[model samples]
Target chain A: MDTLTTPQVINSEYLLKHWQGHRNLTRKVIDAFPENHFFEFTIGGMRTAAQLTAEILAMGAPALKSIVDRSEEPFSENRFNLETKAEYLTKWDESTAAINANWEELSAQDFHETFNLFGLYNFPVIQNIQYFIDNEIHHRGQMFVYLRALGITPPFFWER
Target chain B: MDTLTTPQVINSEYLLKHWQGHRNLTRKVIDAFPENHFFEFTIGGMRTAAQLTAEILAMGAPALKSIVDRSEEPFSENRFNLETKAEYLTKWDESTAAINANWEELSAQDFHETFNLFGLYNFPVIQNIQYFIDNEIHHRGQMFVYLRALGITPPFFWER
Candidate 1:
């Protein structure tokens, strides 16, 4: 009897679904901000809302590109320094759509292959997707602190 | 030459903070979840809130055990199957405290060293923290979707 259990596998479909879920949750959080407040607002001397939005926008394209090309240059934050929230949002939407478009292209076999992401060596495809969504939520967690600090109530986590 | 930027090092700290921060965040998210829903209300066949919580609780002790012993068992999930959420939460809280305590024990030298987690291979301490927090957020993302689908609002992302 083969008592060894198979490892749980996550398909691209699952990754894309989770990706959109983060985007939708984030959109609601972003909407909670006043127009002017969106660009400013910080807690614990961390990145401002606009800056964090830029960070979120920056993750998708660069990450997908990094995974696809197997580049390991530590995805540059300088590449994401944006001037406007609209630009960030637009970029975020585009990135989200791009991931959804290209996700299916990621084969099940690719899940196990190692790729370099930001000079980080030998990361598998699943780890890459894990990193992508985790990055967003980490910043989103920061935004949550900022939102409450600013006396704003973000959408309930389930509202999305 | 010591050319690495301050923000780069700070980014590492940021990543570490994120690991601890979300551990704290999980405590709050768990509070908001009514007990009944703990094992119910999964989105798209994702892990249940209870299962997700089990997964989070598993991160430290088992992984650390594996690392310390250099074992390849990946910490059996069967060990996690227990009677009540309270039992799991107690373990989770204990695990969280253990991580903080152990985190202090590590010096600058220990970060880059490999430590076996999940029987795969040991990652650097910094990378391990990233994996720690990122894994929590992944399941939390699933919880967020479940909350929405069940018409329950998860707490604002940053009540902690």
Candidate 2:
């Protein structure tokens, strides 16, 4: 077992906390959405946040599981199936749990190894992991703006 | 120079390219915003992309310079002063160049070292760097929704 396999470039624990913090913040944004708007509210031609949440759920656990199993599944957009906002949250929790379970299997060294993410882009494991976080954060930002548009006060950004 | 001051966790080269890539992508998003709505468009009371862009510029170059120079400046919201969309773009370019200049002074160890960001949060350099990227990505996502609301096609996310 080589020590460099788990490089200390970014502390592994910090990475875990960082991703989870963003997740927590995102969940709050979801909670703030009015039920009526969850499925129907959309800006421009973008997918509603419900659809976007589906996309996040599709990407998060599935992507991490793929990384842990050393599998490169083809990329796919999440299809909206849930009828209620609660159903979406239920799925989100399941995915979060899955990420936790799979995260334990990812050694620090794995973060440095290059892997094809969903058989789409080939980049180092760390960058691939970042893509997951970045994508979610991006969507979450949109959710925040949505809340404001609906005359809602969303949680502070740094709360997570 | 002791190498302890420049540990190699993540490749430094990759970090530079990653941040710069996001910046380029963000710039394109700015270009996509219509002049009339650049300052006026607001979703749910959220700041328009133009205002958000100003916040990014304030944080980007200014934050990095503080890190390199070891100063602790308080975080301030971006003030809306530009009368035209072109002025906002010019300021953004200036900030981008400043980030490039300041980035060189940050060594790998700096990523691990802790400093108070904007005199608020105290975290390692890497986390702070991640903050910069994450915040911009999040805002950019909002901008995407805004563009979509306006029936404009934002540049692809991965194009950066």
Candidate 3:
């Protein structure tokens, strides 16, 4: 694998598009949950979908902003205070916009630079960004099971 | 985003490493499962952990092999007939090796080529490969919930 000869597989734009595609599917997952179940449902003592969403919400734009600002803020999921599913959807939209805005501030070289994500998880900037998408997918997977358990089918995983 | 100007963020080697990291974490998830629960535990009418593992086992190497052969075999999860946790572990190792072997056969240009995955998903070969990782993480998330339900702590997601 000669780095100089190998063609690049994806660019930052492609990476953002791919991440957003997962976000779109995840928003659908959020929409599919019954309002009550969104906050109250649980399986085997796992966190409710709301709690999981909060963790995801806490990470994305904040992490990106941290990278852009070179700020090492401690990670916290309690930043958002919301009492309803509608509130979560609103916050999700805001975070989506924030991610795009923050993304533009990053140079291609920034991806190779190390950033301590949420003041922890020291890694290359790209890996941290990938982790955001991976984490969302992971949580959304749990929501899929939650939906199924509630007798609802999740949006097709491949549709994204 | 100018396609010509943007630097590529990843190559085939990086993609493989990122994916194998998830596989490593997921393999640990499997190892953490109690044998009986691996085969039979359920929450809210979901498939057991073993069933989910079977679906993952069915996809990874088989999909890569399909791309390498240009053979659009219909997707099937019943290919492996393992009945125990240890058997699944053995098969997982085999599939991991198979993935590495098939990966070597794919060129940088192949990532941009379109292949009908499992004769189902008609997308770029890269997206299909990505689905393999996404699907594994999704199932692993469910297993995480299952582990919690069983009073077990899953491996840290970031450790991957």
Clashes of each: 6, 8, 0
Each candidate's interface RMSD: 17.9, 4.4, 2.7
For B1-160, candidate 3 gives per-residue lDDT tens digits of 5443346677789999999999999999999998998999987788899999999999998889999999999988889899999999999999999999999999877887888887888888888888889989999998998898789999998887
- Per-residue lDDT value at A99 in model 3: 89
Best by lDDT: 3
Q: State the lDDT of candidate 3 residue by residue for A50-152, as single tens digits.
A: 9999999998988899999999999999799878999999999998899899899987778878888777889989888988899999999999988988899
Candidate 2: interface RMSD equals 4.4
* Model 1 spans with C-alpha error above 4 angstroms: A1-9, B1-160
Stronger candidate by lDDT (1 vs 3): 3
Taking the tens digit of each residue's C-alpha lDDT, what string does model 2 give over B1-160? 2324222335555667788899999999999988989889877767878788888887888889989988998877664466678997887788778888888888766777899988987997777888888889988988988898888999988888
lDDT of 1 at A11: 29
Docking class of 3: medium
Candidate 2 CAPRI category: acceptable
Best by DockQ: 3
Candidates' TM-scores?
A: 0.51, 0.88, 0.94
CA lDDT of each prediction against the hidden true structure: 0.61, 0.80, 0.88
lDDT tens digits, residue span B8-29, model 1 = 1122233345466667767766
